[model samples]
Target: MSNKNINRLFEALTPTTEQNEKMFQNILAQSQNENTRRRGFAPVKRARSVVLAAVLMVCLTTTAFAAAYTGLDKTFLKFLSPVNNEQAEYLSNGAYMVDKQVANENGSLTIKQVIGDSNLTYILMNFTAPEGTVLNAARYRFGDSMITTDQDYQSIGFKVLDDGNPVDNKISLVMNIMTKNSIAGQTVNFRFKDLQAADPLPGIFETVIPGSWETAFKLDFKEYSNLYQIDQNITMFGYEALLNTISVSPISISLKIQSRSLKEINEAAGRLKEIGQNKYSDNYPITINYKDGSSETTSIFTGLHLLDYLNDQMLTIKTFEHVINDKEIASIVFFDKEIALN
Candidate 1:
């Protein structure tokens, strides 16, 4: 494949209509938490001040912005989806419309929501320590809570945020998990162990959080299946790339693309560098074209990073998942306008 071929491929890209743009924009905002900040603890005395500040934010942005957004207006989850070089094969395409809060022996834990696809499950939750409990005492870790289904499952990274520093002792987290099973709509266990802080740890926040806050429950969630499939090949900058799989659900979409060799990717990157092209690091420029002629310009949140290009011939495939579910999409315009998979 030559550069001429790549340019020709991208030239065939299609643009979308107007009305459908809003829908995709909303999805981008919701899923990416574009301008939303973390919901920290706010004291009543500070209520007025907070309200004023919020008002300013709304004024600067828009009234509709302030009125909208839920706890689902999260940022960490987006970062978690693809922090390092990992690819998320499947993620929950569930709307951020879940509120599963329950009380435990030591405190209360809210199962904010659960989302996943056939390959992985992401459980988001908030833990409130018992009254008069100073967090940071213990690590407040969750024991093995991966669902024990016929398929294999394992825990990845357990993240806990103490809102803003240590305000009202409310912590939020998105548990990173992976499994080789299809455990959707199945009752799975959610077990979190108590945190014993105030230990000799070498990280941030070295304080004791009093509590035996153990939370356990059976959570039921729905997993999305990508109904439409498209597999095609395009040689970009002399690299033969395979657009392996594309699955779209009501809430999210996933794309699995592979390349033949890493050398080609390296060469392609070099060529882009030579041409002064911007890098595709944090975000991907993707446009979803629906059947209604309305198209959405949203971003692509990455997941797991498959095989290495150097050691293996397989190229690193970018995983796509973001919050957006609306009318059925007809095709997608991507690869710098190089390809359109209908």
Candidate 2:
């Protein structure tokens, strides 16, 4: 379709008020009446227009209902939905119902408060878990957790930490966990804090499963914050005996701040190149230091990139030192050249 027609269709699809729905219904009724009135007297061309208009109305109605249904489904699926024979049995035997009643009766899971500043946001949650269930760990990601374990279902409580406390009302999070067998259970009473400046760039957070019980996760917060001025951090708490079961620790946190501009990183790269050329030699080690405390020393011909130069008959530079300014913020280092010995 033409761009203008597509834009018009989008505008029409946007919901404005209840009057729009009423008008659509009226149009539909009128079209039906017209079809019936012309059942025996209309020309073929006029009949085709009426039929096309009726079809368009039906299409609009279908699109509206589909959008509404999708939203409702998403809301329902966000919470803990029963999954497996074990969970179903628990629900059937009135375990979940009893837990809900207890939660309602005690009223212990209440929103404590929310706090935030210009650069940070925080929400504090205080609640207790049910009997037989202990919170093993809590993690926040840009999306849902990839944990697939039965122990997640046994979680009873959760706490979320932020760069700063929220300044407004408390934010609520509906906690859900997956068991070892890939079963998910829902528990409420978790707190949520949306940081205003915490935006991770694309492809920064990558998860690599090293073993059955251990996963290596890497976060390039420096590279991420380079794209935006927002600073973000992740704080995780491990709980119960499951903490020992996993390879990681009790509490692990990572902080990335928007401290340096893109120009600073480029300047550092340029300085490294100049130092590398001046110190290049056949058998001497090259060392470069920045005003900041950060430094890297590596053999020019021994690292991963050296394999690509095996066929070249050039002098094999083997060692070098690099130094750059270290700001209180995050930084990225790019090796400009291999170190050589004189």
Candidate 3:
């Protein structure tokens, strides 16, 4: 097949897992039919064996690609989520290295490193199996986990990056923690109850050796972000919004916004709900323009506080998929109005 045809064939194939077996079976049937048409003899068993071998090759190739990332630098480059130059460089320098490991009967878990500001924290962790043992799963899910901080906080959420792919023997995981207050300078306690491998079908799981593990580490949060205070009224989706402030960090950019009236708040809430349902839609709160003449749009809206809806007071934080270099930002565009940063 030509290169373009090969690309199309690969794209046409369903993703690996539960559908993989059925797809291979169809290929085997087709191969048998073609062989019989040409030679008047069907090699059914041979065709079946070849199809199964193809499946094995696909699995092995994926595992090999995952294993190619050896060290911190290479591993960071393999992050499924977008990692900008600033975040990658900081991780490469070992500026926030926390090589803490906790081992249980199941295996060992290590906190490779971390990077965060006040509102968010990103943790890099690795799982290593015992000698003669192997964790050969595409992805894993943690069960009954409790992530707490030393200080009393409003809320905390710990999530393993589902978007990331896993490797055999050594599984690398990224934990994204969202908190009500700054997670910096605070010691965090991580407790996990059970670990399971995601099964062939969605919502099905298989336990990974019965065991639990726990660990704690102190986070060194540094303020390497630029904050611009802006109190202006902007019209979005035909509703008036108050632009409170814009904080530009190396890893992400967040914008704080509010509504001017209760009616506007309710209307904006409904509109945002509609936008959230569509994954491909971009919430046009702010656009970051870099010095290199490139721009990025906000991927999601987070840190929403609507308890004070009566006073038309709410905090809307919009985040970018890739990191934003604070120094390289030229300006921010909102509703066709450009605010020069430099």
Scored by lDDT, the top model is 3
Q: For residues 53-162, what per-residue lDDT tens digits would candidate 3 score against the true structure?
A: 88778667655543332223334334422234334444344336689999976788888877665556677777777766666665566656688875333333333432
Per-prediction TM-score: 0.45, 0.22, 0.62
lDDT of each: 0.48, 0.27, 0.60
Candidate 2 C-alpha lDDT tens digits along 33-62: 876887767676776677667656766886
Off by over 4 Å in 1: 1-113, 119-124, 134-182, 185-219, 262-280, 283-285, 290-302, 308-322, 326-328, 336-342
lDDT of 1 at 170: 68
Ranking by lDDT: 3, 1, 2
Model 3 CA lDDT for position 167 = 36
Q: Candidate 3: lDDT over CA atoms?
A: 0.60
- lDDT by residue for model 1 (237-324), tens: 5666676665554434555556656565555544212212322342333577866677766442334334345443332222334334
